[model samples]
Each structure stands twice: as C-alpha cells, then as structure tokens.
Target: MKQELLSLILPSRNEAEGLRRLLPELVTLLPDAEIIVVNDGSDDNTLAACTEFPVRVISHPYPKGNGAAVKSGARAANGDVLIFMDADGQHKPEDIPALLEKFKEGYDMVVGARQSGSHAGAHRAVANDVFSRLATWMTGQPVEDLTSGFRVVKANKFRTFLYLLPNGFSYPTTITMSFFRAGFSVAYLPIHTPRRATGKSHIRPTRDGLRFLLIIFKIGTLYSPLKLFLPISLIFFFSGLSYYLFTFVTQHRFTNMSALLLTTSMLVFLIGLISEQITMLIYKDSD
Candidate 1:
C-alpha cells in the first residue's frame, strides 16, 4: 500500500524559544512531512523565529485561543493524516513516529496518554482524571487521556467535527468524545511529557477547569444524552421509592415530597428516551 502524506501542526503563542529548538528537530526528523505552525498572535518573536525555518508559518492577527489555532492549522494541512502537538516544549518529538505507526494500524485516532505524575499541578491531575472517567462512562470506551493535545487523527475524519469544535482549550475533549460517538476507532499510547522548557502554561486550572467541565458535559450531551439522564432518573426514582416506603410505614401514607420526586423521575426518563432517539437521528450517518 502507498504511504499516506503526514502533516505535523504546531499551535504556538509566545513559544519562540521553544519553537527555535523544536521546529528544527521536526524538520530533520520528518523531512518529507509537511510542517505548519500557526502563531496565535504571540507578542514575542514567534513569527520571526519561524522565518529561518523551512516550515509554512501562518499567523493570526490577534490571540484567538489554542483551539482556534488548531482549527486554522487543520484547515491548512494537506495530508491524509494530521498530527497535532504543543509548541510549549512538553510533547517529545520522538513520540511522533509511534503515533503514526498506531494510525497505520487501522485506527482513526491515536491519543498520547500521559502517565501519572505527568501533570504540572496536583489539581490539574485530579481534574484530568475526572474528565477521563466521565468520558469513559459517556462513550462506553476507556479514554486514557481526554485532554491531551498530542494526538494523531485522519484529516478527513477530524475535519468533520471542526464546526462543532470549540474555540477554546477544550478542543481535545470535544474531538475525542465526538470520534467515539461517531463510531470511529481510537487508541491510546502511554506518553510522558516533560516540564515546560519555555514560557509558563497558558491554562488557568481554576478558570479553564470550569470550562473543561462544561465542555465535557456539553460533548456528553451532544453525543449521548441518555447516558447522563438515565442515571439521574434512576437515582431520583429509587430515592423517591424509598422515601415513599418510609412514609407509608411511619404515617401510613405517601408524602408530597415522594410524589414530586417520582414525577420528576418519570419526566427525566421521558426526556432521556426522547433524547436517545434524537441522538440517533443526528449521528445516523455521521461516521
């Protein structure tokens, strides 16, 4: 079989120094692959730094956000397979080949799952675990790293979700769930990221952390609304049943609270049933 064209996309903002060292390594390591860098309005010499390199550089007028930069890069990439990695000097260049090899194994997407202790902060680690668990339950597939930026995906498949992709840092979470819900095959490979070698991380855990949770719930609802609704419905239904039994034993009658809880449970289940049907209609042929 003929080899597919590969495109390596790096989204940067104030990563001039890191790009100075990383870009050359990419050029030397993967000479034939197309390398494109999208500068997200870095005030530093990010654009000038790429002038000396042989990479195609595209600069935004102002800061658009990391996810926006990724969409810009994906739109410009002309490869059968596209690989995205951070320009913050976290992802290792050597891991690129492994991701490509996994892609060749008939997987539509391959995510670089970071090992434990790979996070820069303790809270970030806890937050990532929560996202992963939520994603795993929502998709019915084990998601090792739902928020990892280092991933390989088929360009054609990835492009389909561009419109749905958020213009923020939660792009990874959105795409990962979308792929799984669309019935695309996804695999995870253990990868270890080093501490930043340049500027500090742009992510504000307390701020972006809330955004991540919202993105997770948004994608979960978009893909599988029933997965979330059904569990809550069951909780309310059982709680109401237990309460009703207790009231019957104590006062020989069912209380209004039990009736309200039971009614809410039925309403929630009805919503989940309707949502399940809508989800099927929406994603019928999306794959």
Candidate 2:
C-alpha cells in the first residue's frame, strides 16, 4: 500500500511533563507524520516545552475546552489523514499505525477503543458504557467507545461536523454521532490507555457529565428525531387510547386525561416531523 501522510493533533493544557515524554515517543512511532499541538491557555511551561520539539504549536490567550483546541489543530493541519490524541499521555503513540490501517479498508473513521481494564475507575467505565450504548441505539450500529479521544479520520469528511461541535469534553460524542448519521463507515480498534504522566484530570464529572448528556440529546434530535420522538409519542398515544377505552367501558364519559395524552402525542409527533425536515435540509446543503 502507498504511504499516506498523517497529522497527529494533540490538545494540551498544563501538561508540560506529559508532552516531554509523549513527543519523543510519537516521533519514534510516526517518524513521517506531522505533529500539531494546540496549547489551550496553559499557565504552566507547556508552551515552552513544545518549543523544544519540532512541532507546530497554536495557542489560545485564554483557556478553551479540549474541543475548541482540536478544531484549531484540524484547521491548521495539512495532512490528508487526521489523528487526534490527548496530550495527557494516556493514548499511546504506537496505536497510530493500527488506526491508519482501517483507512486502507475504505473506512472513513477509526477509533482507538480503550480497554475496559484501562479505565481510571469503575464509575468512569460505567459512564463510558452508558454513553456508548446510547450512541449505538441512536445510530443503529455498535459504538464501542463514544468518549475515546484517540481516533483517525479522513480530514475533509470530519470537517463537516465542526459547526455543530461544542467546546467541551463531549465533542467526541457529537463527532461520532454525526459520522454515523451521515452514513460514514466507522470501525474501532482496541487499545490500552495508560495513566497520565503528570497533572490532574481537568474533567469535573458532575458538570461535564450533564453537558455531555445534553450534547447526546442534541445530536439525537438533529440526526434522528424519530428515534426519541417516536417512543415518547407512542407512550402518550397508548395512554390516551387506553384511558378513552376504559372510560367508555365504565363511566361512558370521556376524561381530561384522555384529551391531555392525545394532544401531547400529536404535538410531539409534529415536532419530530419538523425536525426531520430541517435535518434533511442541512444534509442536502452539505451534499
């Protein structure tokens, strides 16, 4: 197979020590690939450490979320293939080649699925599982790891979902769902995630978890509203139908509960129809 140039994009914040170790390993693993590091307003010596290596560095005066940094790196990258990895040293550089191999099979995106035993804790593992299942249900295909940051994607195809991405940790969820919704082929390669070399995790589970859930719902509504809307509408419709039947059999009178359920069902279904039309329009424009 002909060799393809790959761009390794790393988003960092206060991870100077981690970069010192990660950069060297990446250079050894991917000698021909270009490294693009986006410093998301790190107060530490992260910027200084990057200058020691031959890397293209972009910096934000104020700290932005991981998603924004990734967007910046993608925009600046010149490679045909884009590989995103966290700067915390959790993702191994050796996994790059495995991810690239999927592209040869005509897959548009390949995610490096972290092994279950590699998780920092049980709670994190459970959350990841839940997110993955939700994504699988929404896309009608298995999503092994919705939160994995280690991924390889066709740069041009991945760029289409930029506008819809949130500047938060859940951006990966949005990207995965968007690709699946657009009928892009996605595959996963199991890989081990090591603990970060230094610096504490920036994620606040309570705050970020809620934001992540919101992103999932937003993507669901945008890509396949019927998946959610249909189930909800069905519940209301069935309840209303049942109530009316019971009233006729017993009191022989229609009740307010019956009317309420019927009205809610109609409203929900109508909203879903409108959302579907809007989604079609968005995709049509992309085409």
Candidate 3:
C-alpha cells in the first residue's frame, strides 16, 4: 500500500508526566507524522513537555473538554489520516501502525480495541462491555470497543460530523456510531498497553457514567431514530390494541387507556419518521 500522511492528536489536561514519557517514544516511531498536543487548560508542565519534542501545541485558555480539544486538533490537522489517542499514556504508540494498516485495507475508521484486562477496574470493564453490546445491537455490527480513544480515521470523513461530537468523554461513542450509520467500514484491532504512567484518571464513574448512558440513547436517536422509536411505538401500539380487544370482549367499550396508548404510539412513530428524514438530509452530502 502507498504511504499516507498521518496526524496524531493528543488531548491533554494536567497530564504532564505522561506526556513527558510518551512524546519521545512517539517522535521516534512516527517521525514523519504531524504530532499535535492540545493543552486543555493544563496547569501542569504539559506544555513544556510537548516543547521538548517536535510537536505543535494548541492551548485552550481555560479547560474546555476532551472532545473540544479533539475538535480543535481536527480542524488544525494537515494530514490524510487523523489518529486520536489518550494523553494518560494508556494508549501505545506502537499499536498505531496496526490501526493504519487496517485503514489501508479500505476501512474508514480503525479502532485499537483493548482487551478485557486492560480496563482500569472490574466495574469499568463490565460497563464498557455493556456499551459495546449496546452499540453492536444498535449498528448491527460487532463493536469490539465503544470507548477506546486509540483509533485512526480518514481526516475529512472524521471532520464532517464535528457538530455531532460532544465536548466531553463520550465523543468516542458518538464517532463510532456515526461511521456505522453512515455506511462506512470500521475495523477493530486488538491492542494492549501498560498502566498509566502518571496522574489519576479523569473519568468519574458516577458522573461520567450517567452521561454515557444518555450518549447511548443519543447515538440511537441520532443515527437510527426509528430503531429506538419503533420499539417503543410497537409496545404502546400492541398494548392499546390488546386492551381495546379485551374491553370489547368484557365491557363492550373502548376505555381511555386504549385510546391513550394508541394515540401515543402514532405520535411516537410520526416523530421517528420526521427524525429519520432530518438525519438523512443532514448526511445527504456525505453520501
């Protein structure tokens, strides 16, 4: 395969020590790739560490969010392929070539799927598995990892849906589904990395975890609104129909519950149809 210009975007926030160790190794392996370190209002020596290596550093005056940093890097990147990786040192720079290789095979996006043991804890592992399964069912494709940050994507394609990406930790989830729904090929390559070399993790399960659940629903509604709306509509429609039948057999009259359920079913279905049309229009140019 022919060589492709690659851009490595690292979104950092108070991850000085991690960047200190990671940058040198990355520079050695990816000498030609454009390296960009987005400082999301890091108070630490993150900026200083990045200066040691040949990298472009974009600093946010104040902390925006991880996804915001990604958006910034994506806009500034000048490469055919864009690689997004975590700044906490959990993503191995060596595994990047594998992802690129997958991309070379005509995949629009390639994720570095982490093994079960690679998760920070048991609960995290279980939660990630649930997210993966949910994504798999939603997209009708096997989703090996729903939250892995280590991935390679076609830069133009990745930039097309910038508006849909949230300025938070759930951007990965949003991007993964967007590709699938857009009829783009996605591949996952197994990867392993050691424990973080520096500061603590930024994710708070109770807080960010709740946001993740909402993101799942968002993904459903955004990509395939009917997939989510149709099921609920079916439930209400069936219940209403059954109730009306039972009333006719017993009291010989339709009750308010029957009318309410049927009406709600119709409304939901209509809303879903409208949403689906809007989604199609939004992505029509991409097709």
Candidate 4:
C-alpha cells in the first residue's frame, strides 16, 4: 500500500516557529508515518519552513478556518489511522504513543483529555465543563473533554462524518458528539498541555464562545433534535397548563394568553416529532 499505517495531521496557520521546532522531532519519532502539515493560509513562511522535513504540506491560498485546515489534512491523508494535534505545540509529541495505545483496544477514537490546569484560560475551562456535561447527558456516556483536538481516530470511521464538520474551530465538538450518537466506541486518556509554543490564539472569549454555543445547538439538531426539542416542548406545555389552571380557578374562563401558550406548546412538540424522524432518516445508511 502507498499509505502508511498511521498519519499525523497538524493544522497550522502562521505557525512557522512551532512547526520548525515540532517537525524534526515528529520525523525522528514516527519515521514511518505520513506527516501532513495543512498550512491554512499563513502569511508567514510556514510552507517554506516545512520544506526541510519529509512531511507533506497541504497549503491553502487564503484563510479558511481551523476546521477547514483539518478537513484538508484529513482528505489528503492516506493512512488507516489519523492523529490530529495542534501545529502550535499545545499537544505533546510524547502523548502520541498513549493515544495510539488506547486506540488499539478497539476504540474508534481516543482523545487526549486535558488535565486540570492544562486549559488555556479559566473562561474556556468553565465553558468546556458545561459543554462536557451537556454532551454526557445527550450521549448517555462520560465525556471527559468535549473540545480536545489531540486525538487518534480510525481514518475510515472519521471520514464518514467529514461532511458534518463545519469550517471553523467547532469541528472537535461536532465529531465527538457524532461518534457518541452513532454508537462508536470512544476512549479518553488524561494528559497535560503546556502553553502554546508559537502563534497567537484566534479564539476570543465573546466570539468563539458564542460560536461554540452555536456548535452545541448544531449538535442537538444534527444528532438528535428530539433530545433538545422535547424538554423545551415540555417546559412550555407545563407553563401553559399552569397558566390555564390559574385562570380557570380565578376567573372561570380560558384567557387568550393561555390559548396561545397551549397552542405554541403543541406546535413545538409536533416540530420536535418531525425533527426526530428526519434525524433518523438522515443516518439510516450510517456505517
């Protein structure tokens, strides 16, 4: 086979300094594996810097997004297993073995779960906690980290959801939830990350936080719309019922507000039902 058994994908954007330091070490360690550096429209000499290494560079002409870079790397990779890590060196090269080891135990994907204090900032840490809890409830499985980019996945299985991944930083969230909801085995290995080696983080708390919130909403709608819609429908129904009961007892009449509330409740429930069916049909051919 032309492809190696494993491939390493590093998504980079103006990370020449980190890539220069990282590539040589990765070359020494995983000599046989195919190394792909997806240079996501770096204004710096990221492409030029990678020339000394044997790794492949998938260069984009203009800036797309982190997830877009990842998608490019994934499509270009020719391996049975794919390992994804940051090009900025937040993820450790030494942890690669641990991810591979855990994955060999039959997991479709193995994530490098970030330990306490490994988070980039307090706000992101808290946000990740909330996202993890929500994902755990939705999947009925423990979600140690919902946004860890350090992971090794069976290439075939991962490519199945390529279309679902957005062209943004939220790809990690989408893919993780997709695996859980699709009944694929996933494992997490604890790891600590040092501060980034190079390049400034593009993640702004206000902006990316809102984008991730949108990711959560997309996850709800994509995997199981009913999980999101049913609870909301029930809340509206109960509120409407309470309002109707209060008016019936106090005024001996069904108020227009009560009627509107009750109607809205039923409408939401019907929408949830239809969404659930559509979600099922969409994944019917799923492997």
Candidate 5:
C-alpha cells in the first residue's frame, strides 16, 4: 500500500505554545494527514492555536486527563491508521514516518522507544526502565518501552481495547499490555525526544510513579495471574518446610508458625488457581 489514510491525534492540555509550533511541522511533513488536536480543557489558547491549521480540533468542557483525550481522538478518528503522540513538545514530528514505516511491515502496533538521553530526567529514565523490565517479564517478550506516548497503530485493532483504558495518565501502559495479551503483533523503534518546549511536566516522581507501579501489577494480573502469584506461593511453601525441619530438630514438634505458613501457601495457591481460570475465561475471545 503506497498510501494510507493516516490520522494524527495529539492529546494536549495547557499547551497552546507547543501546539502552535508543532501543528505546522506536522502539516508540512504529512500534508494529507487528518490531524486532530484534542484540547483537554486547557485554560490557555490551545483551541485558538489549532484554528490556523488545517487540522480538526476537539475541545473538552473540563479538564479530562490524557487517557480520556486519547479515547476521544480514537473514537473520532476516520482513518484506518492512527498515530498518537503527545503535544507537550517532547515527541519529535520527524519520528512519525519511521513509526509508520515500521507499521507497514505488518505490525499491529509500533512504539517509538525513547533513547536513554531522551528521557526528561535520569530518575524518570530509571523508573521507566524498571517498568519496562516488569512488563517484559509479564509478557515474556522484550518490552522496550511500556509507557511511551508515541506510537502508530491500526485503528481497528487499537479501538478494540478502548474500554480497557483508564481515564488517567497510564493509558499507554494499558493499551500496550492489552495488545500483547490479545496476541497482536507489537514492535519497537528507537527514537530520540527533546524536552518539552512549553508548560511544566506533570510527572511527579512520588505521585505518577506509584500510579505506574500499580498499573504494572494490575496489568500483570490481567495478563497472567499465576506469573505473579506462583512465586509468592512458592516462597511461603519453602519457608514452612524449612521452619518445620528446624523445629523438629530443636523442639521435636511442629510449631504454630510452620503450620500457619503451610496453610497460607495452600490458600494462596488456590486463589491463584481460581484467578487463572477466571483470566482464561475473560480473554477467551481475544483470538
């Protein structure tokens, strides 16, 4: 396919300056793209900034989060292909072509994995690495960047998981995991990002960091509960055995702690077994 109907969706909030700068570059790069800017209740001139461009603008009455804006863009997009990128100026417009090119090779989704120097800060880089590692373990595939907000995906496949996405900052993580769990083909392309040119970053290490971690556990269970539960169950079981052995040699009797550990392990194993069954039924229609 030489040409694809591409829709570029930018989810923005209080980013009028960034939009003013980015929209023109995007228009010049992909003249025919159906560019859509989702103004997520910005107090600034976000809506006004988009008026001078050829793109369509959607405005929210109140401040909905990033995830909510993405859902709106996905639902309103008319193209077969959807390209989602932040309007905070961190993502480069030039990377869109590379992502689309990767998508053309028959990938369901292609994420723009940010290079090490591209992260907003060193702490953020380390945190993202940790999240990526955990996601890779959960999916049993190398997940380069789980929370990257820049990527291109087939609209049909991408819309299927809209209901699974939370109206929060972690929509990227949710959609990425949902794709993997549904057996969709996913690929990553390394890209560099410059720091945002306008507005302060909303990412606070103490707040958003915990949110990302919670998403990991929630998505981990959604993917495979046993992968998360089995390890804790084993630890309990082994601890009980070791304690029982020590008690038998020292006091010649089974101790309360040993029995408690064994009982808890059995209960945890049962719970995990039930969760696995439920998870299987939940995703039975994935194929």
Candidate 6:
C-alpha cells in the first residue's frame, strides 16, 4: 500500500489532564502523523500542558462547540486523510491504525463504533442507541454508533460537508448522513471506548439533546427531504382525504372543516415537493 500522511484532529475543552496522557500515547503510536488539537475555549491549563508536546494547538479564545473545533482542525490539517478523535481520553490512540487501515481499502470514510457496554452511564448509553437507530433508519444502513468521535475520513471528501456542519456536538450525524447521501463508501470498525481520564463531559442532556435532534432533522431534510417530508405530508393528506370521503358518502357534500383540512394537506405536500427540489439543486451545485 502507498504511504499517506494522516492528520489527527482532537477537539478538546478544558481537558488538560486527559491530554497529558493522551498526547504522549498518540505521539508514540502515530509517530509520522501530525496531531492538531483545537482547544475550544479552555479556562484551565489545557493549552499550557500542550505546549511541550509535538502537536499543533489551535486555540479558540472563547468556547466554540466541538463541531466548530473539528472544523477548525480540519481546515488547518495538511494531510490526505483526517482522523477525528475526542481529547477527553475516551478514545484509544492505539485504535488509530485500524481506522487508517480501513482508509487504505479505498473507502471514503471509516468510523470507529464503540462496543456495546462501553459507555459511561446508562442514560448516555440509551441516548446513543436511540440516535444510532435513527441514523440507521435515515441512511438505510446499520449505524452502530452515530455519535462516536473516533473516525477516519478522506480529507477532500470531508471538505464538502464543512458548510453543512453545525458548531455544536452533532457533527457526526451530519457527516455520516452526508457521505451516504453523496454516495460515498463508509465503513464501521468496532472498538472499545474507555472512560475519560479527567474533566467533566461538556454535553448537557437537556440542551444538547434537543440541539442534536434539530441537527438530525436538518441533515435528514438536506439529504432526503422527500423521504422525511413526504411521509408526514402523506399522513396529513390521507387523514383529510378520509374525512372528505366520509362526508361525501354520508351527506354528498364536503363540510367546511373537511375542505380546510384538504387545502392544508395539499399545501403541505406542495411545500415538501418544492423543498425537495431546492435541496437537490443545492447539493448539485455543491458537487
């Protein structure tokens, strides 16, 4: 296989202690790879600790979310392949080679799927499972871990998604769906994720979870608006049709409510159709 340079992109927020251990392991494991750590508004000594390491540090004066950090790292990367991993120490640097090996198989992207039971808490595990199932349904592929930060992707292919990414924690969803929508090959490699060595998780279940839902909806609409919108529109249309049919069969006339329902249903479907066309045009132009 031809040798290719890899850029390891780590998105961190106040993870000084984790990086202390992670940086050394990464350096030993991926000696030839360039590591870029995006410090997402750390108040601690996160940046200070990284100064002694052989890694490039990109600091965000104020906290931008993980997605923003990943975007910055990607923009600054100088390698043919990009590997994104969390700086919280949950992801193992030793698994980097497995992801890189998958890239050698001509796949556009390779995701590291955390083994079941590796998550820190039960609630988080459930949330991860739900998101993974939703993603699988959207892509019509078995997505084991929709939220794993440990992933390897071809840099050029990933560049196409920079504009669509959110600045928060939902980047994995957008990137996974984008690859499937654009007809790029994506493969999953199962790996175990250990608990973070230090620092609390940045995610707030209530706030980030809702934001995550919105991100999923946005990506769903962009990739297959018709698939998402059409079903809901059809339900509305059918309910209206049923009411109208009932009125016609019983009294030979449509009531005001039935007429209004039918009108709204038609409008909903029409809007979906228009949105689908616009989405296709935008995707085409991007290509």
Ten residues in sequence with the least summed lDDT for candidate 5:
278-287
TM-score for model 2?
0.94
Stretches off by above 4 angstroms in model 1 are none
Better of 1 and 4 by TM-score: 4
Q: In terms of TM-score, how similar is model 5 to the real structure? A: 0.94
**Per-residue CA lDDT of candidate 6, range 1-287, in tens?**
77778899999899999999899999999889999999999999998889979999999999999999999999999999999999888898889888888878989999999897585677678877887887777779888887787899989889988998889888888888878888889899999987777899988887776786576576567577777767777787788889989989999998887877778877877877887888777567444
Task: Kindly give the stretch of ten consecutive residues in candidate 4 with the minimal lDDT sum.
Answer: 278-287
lDDT of 1 by residue, 1-287 (tens): 88889899999999999999899899998999999999998999998999989999989999999999999999999999999999988999999999888878999999999997674688778878888988888877899988899999999999988987888888998888888888999999999998888988888877776786686667667678888888899999999999999999999998999999999999998998898898777667676
Model 5 segments more than 4 A misplaced: 1-3
**TM-score of every candidate:** 0.94, 0.94, 0.93, 0.96, 0.94, 0.92
TM-score winner among the candidates?
A: 4
Colliding residue pairs in candidate 5 = none
Worst 10 residues of 2 by lDDT: 278-287
Q: Could you tell me the TM-score of candidate 4?
A: 0.96
Kindly report which residue pairs in candidate 6 clash with one another. none
Candidate 2 per-residue C-alpha lDDT over 1-287 given as tens digits, one digit per residue, 9 for 90 to 100: 76667899999999999999899888888888899999999999998899888888999998889999999998899988999999888898878877887767999999999886784766678878887887788888988999899999989888888887778788888888888878889999999997767898998887677876676677577569878788889999999999999998999999999999999999999998888887777666442
RMSD of model 6 against the true structure: 2.0
Model 4: CA > 4 A from native: 1-4
* Candidate 4 global CA lDDT score: 0.88
lDDT of 3 by residue, 68-153 (tens): 99999999999999999988989988898788878889999999999856847777778778889978888889999998889999
Off by over 4 Å in 6: 120-123, 248-253, 285-287
On the 0 to 100 scale, the lDDT of residue 198 in model 3 is 84
Tens-place lDDT per residue, model 5, 26-103, is 999999889999988889989889988999988899978999999999999999999999998889998888898899
